[model samples]
Target: MNKAFKYSYVSDFLNLPEPYSEGELQKGLLRQMKDFILELGGDFLFIDQE
Candidate 1:
């Protein structure tokens, strides 16, 4: 819709993947936590442990 089209350009530079919450609860929890932190917007950074 045009209502949100004004900001569509923002997505052009931001190529983010969909939220992934699969497997066990602990694995999903980490994904959700990382997703939350990343969604905070503006200069928020985090490191993921493998």
Candidate 2:
């Protein structure tokens, strides 16, 4: 089967000011976890220490 999936995500909420690192981007996304899940079509869960 040839299926496609997004290994990563992009969202306005994750847009940092500038000069940021990958960790910063991730933190931003987690900070807005609710919206992030919705952005992912509301089919996501936040499991800590993943």
Candidate 3:
């Protein structure tokens, strides 16, 4: 049988403080996610502008 998986949007996982610049939030979130995946020993492939 084939297995299916789901992926989450990065924005949804991030809980940023209000009044933050969008650029800043995006950069912070990406860094956070990268660290988390690394810590978990999971592989990550980023596809920007998807």
The residue-by-residue lDDT of candidate 3 on 1-50, one tens digit each, is 33443553346446666656878677877877766766765466544521
The residue ranges of model 2 lying beyond 4 angstroms of the native Cα positions read: 1-11, 34-49
Tens-place lDDT per residue, model 1, 1-50, is 58778665332223334542334444655666788889997688768735
Measured on C-alpha atoms, candidate 1 has an lDDT of: 0.57
**Tens-digit lDDT track for model 2 on 10-39?**
556566877788888777867787556657
The candidate with the higher lDDT, 1 or 2, is: 2
Against the correct fold, how does model 2 do in TM-score? 0.39
Per-residue lDDT of 25 in model 1 = 41
Q: Compute the lDDT of residue 34 as modeled in candidate 3.
A: 69
Q: Which stretches of candidate 1 lie over 4 Å from their true place?
A: 1-23
Clash number for each model:
0, 0, 0
Best by lDDT: 2
**Model 3 residue pairs with clashes:** none
